[model samples]
Target: METRIDEIGPGIYRLSTYVADIAPPAGFTFNQFLLLGDEPLLFHTGLRRMFPGIHAAMARVMDPARLRWITFGHVEADECGAMNEWLRVAPQAQVAHGRTGCFVSLNDLADRAPRPLADGETIDLGNGKRVSYLDTPHVPHGWEAGLFFEESSGTLLCGDLFTQLGNGSTLTDGDIVGPAIAAEDMFRSSSLNPNMGATIRRLADLQPQRLALMHGPSFEGDAAAALMALAADYDQRLKAA
Candidate 1:
């Protein structure tokens, strides 16, 4: 398995590793976003075993040890399994997440204490890169789930939201909503509830120019429409359930 690196946004890089064993014919891609600035931030750490490839991919763009902030959408293995490994390498790095995540999991999970941000709190990475954390508990699955919006690039580092089964392009102006719903039908990965659709709709308010997905290709072009379409699907699924 080789990890491919691509700059999806101005300074946001996607480090993706495709694993053929996960979903057979289509397979799956585990992606991690690297935001470069005065203080670089890495979103999603991939799996614990994926550290070497991910680290190597990260090194291609910038020194891995220069990473300052580590964060993810939730506490899943694929989301933050290599938390300690990262901290071990980047001595100055600290895991930052929503207050609920820190209070419930990251406080004890992280080697160094984490910085918990309130909803809507933004972290200035310098060079005009700023990320705001939004609490979205149980929207996809985890109770401490949250997402980040990079204000400068209008990019949303949305983890596991538009997950699909494929080793497609690093970035595309394609339809991700259909593939995502198909994957959801197969995996039943999302926590289906009344708030699921509403939570996703709230993200559409960001009007993100690009969506930095964790499993599938990074999407560009009419991201808000795609998000709204996905939300509508979730709402229909809830009614059908």
Candidate 2:
């Protein structure tokens, strides 16, 4: 498993391509993000089976023990299945989730209770870095799904929004409309849940500078506009349906 880490913007970093293989849809190689704020936040931990790789990657960039928050869009195997492993490494780090996705406790995981994060909630990373969480109920495949947008860096840690058809290589969308169209088509054609359009509209209002989708490449610049365009497209598709 090869991991490539890149600094997308000031204090925003992405770890992509967990493995080189592309077979079986390669579900574990999803994008993992690290936000360098006062207390570093790890977003979207990989599958439980990849803990060794995940730990190695964290050690390469940061002291695995210093992670302060473990966050994800929803509770799933690829997204937060490594929470127990994370607690093993960073004993002090808190596992954050939305109200609807709350779990009582994983027996072997850390003793820290899950923190319920709500929509419009802002995580204040001291030294001027801050991220706001937007509740996206069905954008991905989770009922308690949500997206995180960093205010200072203009990066959105979108979960499974712009998933592409390839290994987790470097795939970024710079063109405003290209990725927007792709994401819109994907959700409308593939998604079975409602409220995606509404979620997109709310995300557009954030006006992010980067669209950091979990599955595919991260789109830089005018994240809000891109989200709005995708939302509008999905809205149209829904209307026609």
Candidate 3:
């Protein structure tokens, strides 16, 4: 497994690790988005087993221990698996999650106390970057799930929403929706929560230009339109289920 880091946006880097044949017919990627700000933030911790590679990737940008906030969209191996490892290395780093995630799981699992953000709350990331946490619990998977939108750069740190299945790229401006839908169909990983579609629609309101996904390329350009369309499709599928 090899890893690399790409600056997708100003002060925003996508650290990706790719492994071949992990998903049977295709390779897969585990990504972490790092926001370089007065208070540096790391989104998604890759997997617990991949800590070595993920940590090395962080070194390319700055010292891993300099991280101030470690956050995720949900409670999953690929989301917070290396949380404690990060807490160990970055002594000042605190786990940030939604209120539910903090109370239900993070409070108990995290090595340090978690900073719980309220729904629609904004955390100042310095350098004019403000991160808003959209509570999208059960829309994707975890009861504590949520996504981050960096206002300055319009980058939606959407974990596992538009996950593609292959040895992924660092970034893409094409129709990521098509491949993401196919991957969702094959994996059937989204939550069956009835409000899932509505949750997705909320993201459209943000009008994000870049969607930094967890398992694939960070989508660049017109993310709001793409997401709204996907929301409609998800509405139908979820209703059928």
Candidate 4:
């Protein structure tokens, strides 16, 4: 397991861990995003077992204990499995997620209460950086699934939307659409929700410059066009299935 941290956006850092020889043929990558600001928010805590690595990675840049907000798109183990562990280290930090996630899981599981945000609510990270929450139910997987977009950086902290196979790289401008479609075919991780297309289009309309993914690598390119391509492919794939 090799863990590293790299700056993707201006002050946004991506903490990634690559696990070779996973069940999949291409291996896997677990990523977490840390944005430096007045409040200092961290998106996705990776798996609970990766806490030490994640902690060590953050220590290289900033104090992990000083993090104020621990947020995620959904309630999956890879997403919030380490919520309590993070709250244990950062006493001042609060668990944050979409209202659905908080009501469905975090309210009962988390050691600390969660700051639930409405569909369009925004959380100020200070230093002119703020995150606007988008309630994307079952777009990728979870019923409480949602995502966040940074206003200053135009980066969408999209969780599992464009999941690619293999531990590719830190970021890429090439075609991830093909790899993501292949993964979707193999894993069937995407949802069968009727509103899936609408949800995808919503994220595309945001016109994100960077996509902070959880699995595989991050992306820097025309997110809207990529999203549209995925949406169209997904529809065709679903029909074939």
Name the best candidate (by TM-score).
1
Cα lDDT, model 2, residue 87 = 79
Clashing pairs in 1: none
Who is ahead in TM-score, 1 or 4?
1
What tens-digit string does per-residue lDDT give for candidate 1 at 158-209? 8989999989888999899999999999999999888988899999999999
| Winner on TM-score (2 vs 3) | 3
Better of 2 and 4 by lDDT: 4
Report RMSD for candidate 3.
1.0
Candidate rank order under lDDT: 1, 3, 4, 2
Candidate 3, residue 141: the lDDT equals 85
Among all windows of ten consecutive residues in candidate 2, which has the lowest summed lDDT?
Answer: 102-111
Candidate that would win on lDDT? 1
Error of 3 at 208 (Å): 0.4
Tell me how far candidate 4 lies from the true structure as C-alpha RMSD in angstroms: 1.1
Show where candidate 2 strays beyond 4 Å: 18-29, 103-111, 167-194
Instruction: Name the lDDT value of residue 36 in candidate 2.
Output: 77
Worst 10 residues of 1 by lDDT: 1-10
Query: Per-residue lDDT for 1-241 in model 2, tens only?
Result: 6667777777677777544454344443477888876689989888887777767866787888988888888767888888878877887798777766664333224356777778888888776788787777767566777778888877888887755544534545565456436544644423544687777777777677787777677777667777777676667666778
All candidates: TM-score:
0.99, 0.84, 0.97, 0.97
Better of 1 and 3 by lDDT: 1
The lDDT of each candidate is 0.94, 0.72, 0.89, 0.88
Candidate 4 residue-wise lDDT at 55:
92
**What's the ranking of the predictions by TM-score, best on top?**
1, 3, 4, 2
